[model samples]
Target: MSVAVASASAPARKALWKNLGVQVVIAMILGTLVGLLFPSFAAQLKILGDIFLRLIKTAVAPLVFLCVVVGVVSAGDFKRIGKVGLVAMLYFEIVSSIALGFGLVAGNLLGIGQGMSATTAASGVKPPSAAGAPHSTLEFILNIFPDNFIGAFARGELLQVLVIALIFGAALLHLKESKRLPIERGLNAISDAFFEFIHLIMWVAPIGTFGAVAFAVGSSGTAVLLSLIYLVLSFYAVVIAFIVVVLGGICAMFRINLFSFLAFIKDEIFIVLGTASSESVLPRLLEKLPTYGCSKQSVGLVLPTGYAFNLDGTSIYMSMGILFLAHAYNVPLDFSQQLGILAIMLLTSKGAATVSGGSFVVFAATVAATGVLPLEGLAVLFGVYRFMSIAIATTNVIGNSIATIVTAKICGEFDESVLARTVREEMA
Candidate 1:
């Protein structure tokens, strides 16, 4: 860990608002104020953020495709690429399980949902439609494989797109070096173009942040938030504990200072918070993690894959939300029942990102599948989803960033000096 002192020779800092993080933070503050004082006006501002999300959604599938494909061919080793992917998936499963079980344990121990039937009399938000909820494990597995290759991209199905990238990478891996280089170069160029596209889109991020936060607060209002303050605070408490205890321990094992690591990615983390969607920062993370000394291959494979497979925060929220419903509605879930829910969540949570409406949609699906938790109970949460998302999305981004670096280290693709350089900036 490098601890460089602040130096007089450092360049003058730009205007604070000119910085992306500053602009986003300012937008959030303005958004909250508007939500509190002028909700109707804030409601109208939601389209601004919707437009930004649409732009990000459109760009991500292709970008993931290109990143994995490019990462695969560029490394020039099929064995190494396969190893990294395998390791990342394993890490994702282990850590996500921990997150799942931890949430249940915490929620149960804290009785996080003990009295919700009386405190918040009416759920402010209407329940979301559960039309896409899968009925069985087999149905969920089949949903992952795309029927049409081009259609997958057209539909912006990330898991399908990921499948295509892996197959494409495998095909390229088998090609003669003479033939592969040209293809790799072409793909690399396209990937660079997409990165530039993300940069262009990012300029409008503050506008989007302002709109998203405004709409969330405007819709829910402080009244709704206060009613369920315990649930909100409890969930936040769990997320913070997970970060400090779980993620912090992982970083410690690698000798990486978690605080410095978080500081290095502060800008992207803020972007996630403002947008309340982890997908918004996908393009930026793809470009940034490599600078942390993680090999491009490891980053390209692990990070994009982590978005769906390794959402520690989402798992915790889903598990806790279910327990909250069960408790609030006076439903008792036995050990076997809770385990069944956990198993369902492990599958549904991975598909949440690929599905429209993200995790909440999937959360609804998981609830419906349980055949016990009152699906109606989900309305109790809908109003506060956006607020919870601010922290949830931040946690997901932080978790994935750490997962990528750890995967890189495991695969012998890390450079200590690069991380040292990154930490120096945080220290300074």
Candidate 2:
């Protein structure tokens, strides 16, 4: 009996080791240890993270374009697509503004970043240029339209690709079924192929995550975390509260269990934690959300748009960061001044979705644009940005996923029975 039990357990152990989530967790732990024990060597591992992100990015433009075109064509109604877009934008603005306000309130009440002198903060670090200058509202809007179609995909510009996909998809809607069927089928086949490609790339996630965490820890050193622990803790606290109160409420209103939803997407959540880039899991989300009963149209339209527009996590970071700097530098920001900061962040936060390093760049630009606080103050956050990014990226993914479901429900596109059945299967 003992020999038989051991033989059975061997297969169980092998299967556990084969699980991706288990491997990723192990990679994160080993990466942390390497970073702590061999800082110099670990820093050199940055290339691993860079390569993984580049691979994922290469697929993003084409995947997004194909998904959007297929979604739009399948829905078969331009007016309905327009309505969904309008509602999604409205939802994004309201929720994102609320997140900004929540962050500001949290920062003021907690008094994080206080008692640190601006000179002391700026002592060692050279200030980054206000390289990400705030574009005027008109300029920002105009920039969304790609000057050349191929350039958009070449540059991996999501908003530009979205525009091209929208036009292409709308044009497809006017074609006769005989003419459209073959093209739609072709696009769907290509989109499936891209998803398979994404799966192949994901096999490297453990190595990629290990390098990312190791480089972050190795370069910054753990000592910096002690000095900025309060800011980090406060930011995390705000994120949890937002999820429980804001997103939780939304889930309750939809009669879905927030905990169950979180459990269902736990794999993607872990991936975000490892990669620190929500875009890393875009293809997975596009495939999974439909299984949860959200219409493909809503998932394709709302989820991608939410990435660019919703950005609750980025908004929270921006508001809190500004206040943290203000308090640290002893710069007195009155109600009107803080409001001005909020106003500026509303626009700059949208720009955060444009690229890697975008959140920090936009934060720098917002501070410069408002002139409410000195730009040098941003240097203080350099040590903690990577740590903070993990939280922000994870939150953004959760928020976007929820947004897709909510939008689908509002549009009456969601199938409640299918959602219930999927959740049951997942739990089992």
Candidate 3:
């Protein structure tokens, strides 16, 4: 009987090891090792990595659209949804500013870009102003209204889609019940279809993870790793502090246990770290939030919406990195100039997602907007940027997770009793 029980447990253990995320991490490590040892072989495998990233990008827009619509429409109260959104937006802004401030503080103290000779390596990339860039604020606002909805979606413009969805969802909520029910059902069905699509795409997650990690490790290697130890350590330390200080403060303010909240979402953190894209963990985070006292509608809405508005980690990195570069070049800016950066960064961070290299784009835009340093200063940080990307993306994941739960709890959508009971019982 004991042998039979052991045998049954063995298969389950094996199944656990085969979890998609676990498999992805293992694949990433193996791919990295391969790339480091055999660069030629790893180069051949580059297509595999590229395909995986493209796959994630492809799924992102539709998934976000469906989830956001469903989340908004399913809510029992429009006023309450608005309240939750207001709190979330306020939380995002305050925390993001704090993150930006911390980044500035850490970057100045550490001087990651110090002693680096400026280069024209990024010359051909087209500086925002020189490239005849439109006024960003006006452009950003204008782009929110899609001239072609299908075109916007095809181009994978998340901000535009989010704007459109929010407006449409609000309209749906204001409709008379008899008229609204069919539309709600249709939206729900579309959301279900998207979830099914998510499951289908998830099969490739392990492959993609391996590809991303391999590409990063192979392209960068341990030599770069060894050289940037101080900078890496500095960035990570700030990130950790942000999680503990900022998020923890909020959690405590709400009487939520920080440890319990983090413990419940440990797996989600690992996913974001390994993949370096918080969007990759959206479905899983949504699934897990209900278990953490968030209602299904709250989880569904907040998680997707937060991707655009509540990128706390990205905010921190952008703020810190820009200051680090400025300090490195010995560029002296007056208080007014610094204030200009602070103000522009607030808007640039919102447009951060629209750019190709995440924070790098925002960093570039910041340089342009600030007019404080040579634009090429952006590329000077490229080598270390990859290292910083991981830290930034990880923080974004944790911040959003905490934000979702706290917002849900505040709006009376989440169960305090469940949160308290679970923290005492199942949560570590």
Candidate 4:
């Protein structure tokens, strides 16, 4: 009854034109055409994406806090919540490392950056600075905890906000049911409201995606994309392979059909493609995953934490980006040296989501940490970052969705019947 009721309540049918995914696809086609014909006008449309991002950001902190708090209270066992967290972190570390390895192997095999001459393009294109990134393990740990709770929300620091929510949820566990239940009820209502808020924000998704694609396509000609088109195209191929081979295998092991699971969340995939940011669908996942038979405890505990640590797609980008730079400059990395870089990437990729510019920023920090890769090479790659970002964001959203479902299954928080029901509804 839990998930069946929630999922069954969703409108099972709508006109194709009224569907958000259909609308987004149409907007993307229109936007691409506009970018090709009116580059000048498309450049100005970037504001539409910026505004959408701002509104989405405002909803994230509160939504995450509420979901985690309610999930914790609803589970009725602090020990179980603790177990879910541990399982999620373990899953994140293992899968992310695999993603990094895939990227490194693909770079070596494809030689995507070979014969590239970027010295002229690299100059004057400022590399993203790594100076502000945490220089040590202790510094990184310290940054996760907020000194000012409200300030964390204001600054959109997701890790800090997550820490606050976990502690707040644990504190609620200590309260008696009579007192705690009412608070939980109120939080749940607010969570529903935030879900509604996301639906409203989603209305502007096509507009935002249009502007984003328009800007990306319109401005790409001026960038170094043509010279490095091989890297861009190879990166996409590598990502696709990683998805089908690695993530597909994971789905198979867990008895979840990869195609069906992908179809179930195709809307989220397309939206991420349009906006080129997985954060755009964060709240929507929180609302939808539970209906897909994942418990609230698993969805709430795993998704946000996965955003921080389980960034499988970004993991791939960071390693491949690093290796590609070394190749572009003809900096020969021995087997041992490549392994060392992989080790550094494991740490750097975790920061991808927390950083403002996402994986590109963390990739910069990885380059700085290695000291072998030329930082200027980063600037040349920046020219094509947005092009690669669409695939990265799409992969990430799918990876985290799978992670949540896997976590739910392992923790005994999943319902097979609920999943079957949702699938029927989706197919219908």
Every model: Cα RMSD to truth: 3.3, 3.3, 3.7, 4.2
Q: What is the lDDT of residue 76 in candidate 4?
A: 79
TM-score of 4: 0.95
Tens-place lDDT digits, model 1, residues 1-428 = 13344455566777877899989999999999999899989989999999999999889999999999988877777789888988999999999999999999999998977877875456656766878766667877888899999999998888788889989998998988899889998898899999999999999999999999899888787777887888899999999999999999999998778997888888998899899989999999999988888988888888888987999989999989999999989999999999989998988888877777777888998898888877777787887888898888888999999999999999898998887787676566
Each model's lDDT: 0.88, 0.86, 0.72, 0.86
The parts of candidate 1 lying over 4 Å away from their true place are 1-10, 119-121, 423-428
- Candidate 3 — worst ten consecutive residues by lDDT sum? 123-132
TM-score of each candidate? 0.94, 0.94, 0.86, 0.95
Best by TM-score: 4
Worst 10 residues of 1 by lDDT: 1-10
Alpha carbon deviation, residue 77, candidate 2 (Å) = 1.1
Candidate 4 lDDT by residue in tens digits, 1-428: 98999898877667889888988898899889988899888988889988998899899989988888888878878789988999999999999989988998899999867788644364355757666666556777887999998998897778998999988988998999899889988898888888899999999899998998898878765446667778889999999999999999999999888898888888989899899999999999998998899998889989998888888878888878877888888999999998998888877777776667778888888888888878778878887888899999999999999999999999999999898898887776
Top candidate, metric lDDT: 1
The deviation in Å at residue 284 for candidate 4 is: 0.6
Which of 2 and 3 is ahead in TM-score? 2
**Residue 49 in model 2: shift from native, Å?**
1.1
lDDT by residue (tens digit), candidate 3, 1-428: 99998787753334767676577678768877887887666656667656756666676777677666767788766786788878888877887787777777777667766764433242222323322222388976775677877776787767777777777778888889999999888877876776676678777777766766667776666655665566678889989988898789988998878887776777667666667787777766766687778887777667766776788788877777676667667787665776678778877787666555566666776777776676666554665566678788888888888888888878888886766676666622
